[model samples]
Target: MLVLLLLWTGCGSAVPPELAPDLILHNAKIITVDPDFRVVEAAAIKGSRFLAVGSNDHVLNLAGSQTSLVDLEGRTAIPGLIDSHIHALHFGWHITKHVNFSTGERLTVESMVARIGEWAKNVPPGKWIYARGPYSLDFVAEGRLPNRWEVDAVTPENPFFMNMQGHVGVVNSYAMRLAGVTKRTPDPEGGKFVRDPKTGELTGIVYEFPAMNPFRGLIPRHSLEDNLNAVRKANEVFNSLGITSVVNLAMPQWEFAVLRQLWRDEGLTVRWTAMLRADARVFLNKPYSEVEAEMRALGPPTRFGNDWLKINGIKIVLDGFVEAAYMREPYLEDIFGKGWRGILLWDRESLKSALRAAGKYGIQVAIHVTGDAAVDVALEVMDEVDREYPVAGRRWSLEHAGVMPTEENLEIAERLKVIISTQQSMGWSIGKTFKKWWGPEMGGIFAPNKTWLQALGHPYLKAGSDNRPINPFIGFWAYLARKDVDGEVAKPEEALGREDTLRLYTSNAAYGIFEEKERGSIEAGKLADLVVLSEDIMSVPEDQVREIKPVMTVVGGKIVFQQGS
Candidate 1:
């Protein structure tokens, strides 16, 4: 009867059930993270939102006989963390795609070929042998990439392809032939088909995502059931980490559709907002004009979906990764040997036109940049587009701004009210590569979270794991402790405080997707998404931040995960 009342009264009309909370959590420290950052003793959840937040006595009094009561036993609770930027579908796809590598396994060509042989023998014919990671020849025992003849002997009956950190890739002759790779084939713009240095022959090595496009296109698509289960496993991992929300940039757009279906089935515990990647590379056959028309034709506009699933907008990756980031100055060394500043994905005027077309349609534009020069290009285009669309408070984002931050760029982003979605895990994953690859001055610019915090408040700066190592604590340790995988401090000067980091992961992340008013904090009338921690992240020593874990995670007033369960 009471559930019927809530259903009839709805979330509006201020249901008089304020005296009867559906769930009461007491005997715990509740970090409200409200305007005052108040720490309360208890919080009451009625339906999908917090009914009240106050002392234990105050909240327990509101609970009725039907209410679910849980004694937290003095655990610490905080707002559920949100990953501001993520490749959601990509994470799920690896599972369904039959990825062959395990976590932290050093890859080798012989191991890879053997794995392919095993799959061919055991898993039946016609399945593509696939694996991807930082699996370059650097790890192969021979210290060199296996050429076509070597791979063909094993993979002649099966197609085999493995990407190295999504940067470089090695494909077997069978896969190459199937994908129509010929010696006469011209390299795609901003991508390379690496040839043997001495022989001037095609070496079966591909550089950049654009170059791998044709080969990647050859892989057969997985089934809907396979994809659905993959996403379920992904969400379960996220729930265990206390992640209740994410801003997913589903590159292929198919992942976005599957997530919505999962949500409809009541299987998704994490609230997700999607940004369809606006990569012109995908439509290789279509002209730019047609692509622009499609951009303008994108339906329902930005922020069109509801709280659970929404269309955030489109993401335009203007440049490449660390070494390929378009820098203002030439690289200290010609790493790519392309006169090395960086590779620009799209040309200027044409990209500007694309931005205008999307902006004119009221589609929120999220531009990705990692270099100073790339930042300039993004800002100029956005500024011009903002004049027409008004970007202030529009939450137009600049993803991956940490690689090459400048005070000038920071000020411009601040003035335009652009959100900077950053990942410090780059520092962790890249490990000690910064100093060697980009020089000391460039390395210092890796991820200046403190500098970013000064330029843009906690609310304007968002934190995410990028894709790998989705544990928020692992990312937090990188930011707070400033250590790389080698246990060496990458840069001590750029470390962030726990409070600022927490806000970036929660309240600040909420604002990025326009969900700040609905969630991000533990105040009354806000969504009851929260985490019970084994140890207080704020109170723990800097080195121990990564040791903290979520005891339980709750989303939309229900416990989605518990450590023991």
Candidate 2:
């Protein structure tokens, strides 16, 4: 059936043989996430952009003999997904540089200890055995993090530092001794060196950068070549998931340096814009004046590079989530007693100075603020900055606000015209944690994606997976099913429909990185980036959505990944 459906023209007009499309994909459902959400039958690509998006006959006729043709065999295709927030460099290092203890199964305390035990024998005593896990300790079989003593059993001499996520970790006694962390050592501001409550002894458990940096600083930095390779490996994984573009929320100078080198060498696979971190550690104890001077010196301004790679903003992770999300009210289960709300990483004045500096350089600021109280503080700072110099249309974002911030704060964000960059994908994974820490009342508001969408409007609310498993489908399933780890629907009233969820990861996500005009939707003149799915995502059972893998991934008219290739 050669359906002559022309997306734009309505009438299929033939072009001259000399002006034919370079490539055509026909006999497939092309879900063009345009204003009308048209479902076209085919698409034509010329150079690195779309020439036409229509029916099989409309596009197939436009392909010349020299043009390439891919018969999709009735598969469903959508625009290549754009991840609004990712830590690709860190993810890369997690996979390549560090010793990974995950193997498609849950890690028990026994297996994790044994894995490190084997790896320690290869290296010298002083060497740091930096091991990474798949996701957090929540994913482990023992249902808790392996103790420091268990790690010490593996490596008595070496300083063993094993982390689930970067923030939460366990370190051996040797590592503790080497870092000068003792039972008497005081807790760092905004981070914790967790100790036994009854025993008053160091448990060797660490939380946040402040507490972890001591041991982290001991590890040697990866070389430029190592980082470049890590980025390549990370890109491969992203491409496999049909992700063509990403906005890295927290990228270090060295990682950005590696990416820049990749861009210069034409070695990049995924499109990304890095948000350089405003390191709290670097400016710690320094006054606003000194910090402002340093920030003012950050050159090249924002949006410095080209399409594939650019420095678009500065990221400030304001507070920790789960245990320490800066909250208005006290936590349901106060890990730290005394009716504690979460702690802010930076003081009020320092935060204001950082924002002021970023504004001076016309840099976009995306603060990682999860709790409502943190959002309040961030908005107050932004409002102050706006009073100084209007940031009305600057695209400053509140990363992870969709998860915890109240509807009122979201409304404030809307009024301020601030973007809400969130990880809809993390809902299912972190839902139980929310329940345990924040209780049922607070946990019910896990991912109010609908509320966020209604408040911020569609384009202003962007989506991404902040952590592994980095599959966007996990988020998609969570959004569609509204299910948590226990299969309980979290915040059913705030749940989203299929199309709306797709918009978040596609058109909406593209807008987050300020690249919507180029490649978010399937349209003529847009970059030819798309993914052919293994099944019809629109018709697939919500439970099976996570299994819908990408058959082929195309970026800028180039096929970057193909299954069974």
Best candidate (score: TM-score): 2
| TM-score of each model, in listed order | 0.89, 0.92
Give the Cα lDDT of each candidate.
0.76, 0.80
Which segments of candidate 1 are over 4 A away from where they belong? 1-19, 100-121, 135-156, 182-186, 198-203, 281-292
| Deviation of model 1 at 190, angstroms | 2.4
Candidate 2 off by > 4 Å: 1-18, 101-104, 121-125, 197-199, 281-292, 402-408
Candidate 2 lDDT by residue in tens digits, 1-565: 1233233224556554566778899899999998789999999988889888887866776766688999999999999998888888877887787778533356788887888888888988787888886564445777777788988888998988877655677888998888899999999876788888898788888887788889988978888788888889999989998999989877877778888888789667789888888888766667767877877665456767876888887889887776788888888776766787877887778888888878877888899887778888998888888878677778899888745565567666777788877675555666666677677776522666777777778788777888645788776777788776557776788778889888888998777777778978999989999999999989998899988899999999999999988
Clashing pairs in 1: 133-165
Cα error, residue 342 of model 1, in Å, equals 2.0
Report clash pairs, candidate 2.
Answer: 425-475
Of the candidates shown, which would achieve the greatest lDDT relative to the real structure?
A: 2
